[model samples]
Target chain A: MSFTLRFGPVFEAWRELAAGVWLTLQLSASAMLIGLLVAVVCAWAKVFGPRWSGWIVNVYVEVIRNTPFLVQIFFIFFGLPAAGIRLSPDVAALAALVVNVGAYATEIIRAGIQSIHTGQIEAGLALGLRPVQVFRLVIIKPALRAVYPALTSQFILLMLSSSVVSAISADDLTSVANNIQSRTFTSFEVYIVVTLIYLVLSLAFAGAFRAIDRRVFSYPVAR
Target chain B: MTRFPSRRALAGLALSAALAVGLSARPAAAQTVDEIKKKGVLNVGMLVDFPPFGITSLDGKPDGFDADIAKELAKSLGVRANIVPVTGPNRIPYLLTGQVDVLVASLAVTPERAKQVAFSDPYAGIRIVVYGKVGAAVKEPADLKKFAVGVARASTQDVSLSAIAPEGTNIRRFDDDASAVQALLSGQVDVIGAATPVVGEIEKIAPKGAFDTKITLREQVHGIALRPGQDDLMKAVNAFVAQQAASGALNTTFRKWLNTDLPELKKPAI
Candidate 1:
């Protein structure tokens, strides 16, 4: 028996793959930005806000982190329609990604926040800096810098996990690759190309994160 | 530095080499009725997920129309039936690779498949239909425009529906029929491309008259598939099918599972 790899058909459907890649980028980028905001707020609530708000944030994090992303997405896409909350597949996918990453990032950012020295915060306050300013400039800046690597890695994972959104027919990169594989019956070639695309995308993201780290977190820190 | 293959190219080479070795390692052979009888067990491949025709029984055994037929065939051949579960995509490979003597896996007979495996007389049939909510205004394939359709990816329904869907028809392909039906039931898609028995399953769970068959897509016949050159086994299987049809055993099984009389079974012209 002889087997040959035919990548011609896979490359011919480049337009669909390109669209899928674009959607993946859009979903990941938007989810990262919004999820970061969510994580920051939740972290603050857990560490400094009122006890009731902290408890609520704790519940949200536990629920999202405990369940599988596939089930969460299914509940939002399929289960929510019963409550008159029917979201389109792409929107549901984005919502799931945001909710999922937000929880993990909350725990990561919380650890970073706790690592911030109490003396530094007090010194900022004593220098006539307002509470909000002290928290944002003195606490959050260093906290984010300390946890930058973990946060970026989580973002990359969120991008990879976005592939499962195709379960709801969200038409992400993996879904498009599957569609092509089915059409062409060139499963190996299609998957190989998709794997390369994902690898390149991950590297590009990692490189971008590194560039951001050098530019934003370059300030000297006392030992 | 000496020139070397890029890492990407090296990875591609290694993957292709591995796949080539794996694919070529399988030794293909056709099984005769005598060999199966000598072994005292007929390794019959059938699907476990597809309902009515193929399904897992409450006792965790394979039990359905296909399973019954496989057992009857084995009994007629004086051999015990060893039902090995197979999936839609790999049923033919199971037959060709000698993993199973024959496939009663609800595999639809088509010309493309005819080139790969020999098909006996169709033992069962299913009607693929465009089933949907009662209120949808879909009357024909052309009228499917602006409607969101769900189908199991790479299925017969997906292939057939993609053929006639209008330019604006929104077809969402799920991983399998269950998921596609889920999308339709949950209002994720306006309609779905599914088989009659699947629609029957949906009717049991969904409210009465909530959905109906919008349009018939294709009536696909399933055959017992054997490795391409198994003329002797093919004849024996066809004889068994003829005897069963004459005895009304096939119809009885059909009624037990699908609650309907067996439609006239015809060997599709390939």
Candidate 2:
């Protein structure tokens, strides 16, 4: 079989495609960091804050987790502009990803918080640690260690799901592949190349997560 | 140790790859007048999703300006017009693969396309223009620098608008012309880049004096496309187009569907 695959045009547009990959990387990375913070806050609120605040967090998490990401992104990009809150595609995409990943991460992080033994927190309090210090020292750090794998996997899934933002004309890697395929009409070749790029990106992210895991979670306990 | 592809899977992959290569090597089948006559049916590919020029009638059959033109061409050849629905991206491939005898899909006569399919004399024309809400103060492409302009993704209008728009112009791309028009109506976008026919439909619903054409981007003339080297069929199709244009029949059809007289077609130089 002598089928020719043309990478010439796809590579010639590398600058734009590389820019698209970079944007996807930046968008997802920022969303992961910010969304993780939101998750931590919401999970903490649900477990320890007032009942009314916990109720609000529960509703936010459920509403976001139940709805499709496509609709969520559309609402942020297309729906919110009606309320005089216009946002650029990249910013809107980032907001939507953070909103989505934060909800799912909230549930995962809550499970992490719940797994902490009550005695550990009580011991910190007995030692006269402040409430914030007790939470940091007794609950959160160990809880995060307990659930780090689940949280990181959810983040990788978020990175993949960010492809949906192309529907709103965000210059992500998938959109770049789409434009290239449409212009070149080499649909097969373009998709193959893009699929490989996405694979490499996922593996790279996995490796980075592993490196972070070694640095943060590998220490032996001070028994 | 089991090989990764597991022999069976490897064979299947090889078979599919061979089939794919074999399909690409298909020689262009030259559609001829006599073959269509023998079949007693002319398969004319036209787009159904595009309005005015191509649309599905209330009866669930393709019927529009392009459909009417296809009917008249088939009538001239004394054959039934089998209206085959085709999309914009696949129309040329359909013609090249001999899946459809001819295309009346509102395909613009572009130099890049000329290499693939032989086009007849110009049969229809469309003018793409930037339109917006009235008093938007958008006079030219440069004036659009500050506004959010929406166009259907990768459409002819999108390409043209991108070429003329300044770097600061934010061109939002919707999935199709309908969505782009919806964006304008919903006030989601400040302006739209679309063809005149789509703009005409928008004008029917949008209040009069509420929207106006900002600037004409480019005028494109469409032609019937036949497979390459279908010289006889190509000549016959061109002759039919000339008759339709001269007798005012095409204009009447245009008015019936488009609610306007046919735009004058300036046929490209042979």
Model 2, position B24, has a per-residue lDDT of 82
**Per-residue lDDT over B113-137 for candidate 1, one digit per residue giving the tens place of the 0 to 100 score:** 7766789998788899999999988
Model 1 stretches with alpha carbons more than 4 Å out: B1-48, B56-63, B69-103, B112-118, B225-247
- List, residue by residue over B114-165, the lDDT tens digit for candidate 2: 7667899988888999999886888767988888898876577878898899
**Which has the greatest TM-score?**
1
Model 1: TM-score for chain B: 0.85
Quote the RMSD, in angstroms, for model 1: 5.2
Interface RMSD of 2: 2.9
Error of 2 at B216 (Å): 1.4
Q: Which stretches of candidate 2 lie over 4 Å from their true place?
A: A1-4, A117-128, A184-186, A220-223, B1-50, B53-105, B116-123, B166-170, B182-189, B224-253
Q: Go through the candidates in order and give each one's C-alpha lDDT.
A: 0.89, 0.85
lDDT of 1: 0.89
Put down candidate 2 lDDT per residue, A77-144, tens digits, no spaces.
77887788878788989999999999999999999999988988999999999999998878888888
- The lowest-lDDT stretch of 10 consecutive residues in candidate 2 chain A is A1-10
Residue pairs with clashing backbones, model 1 = none
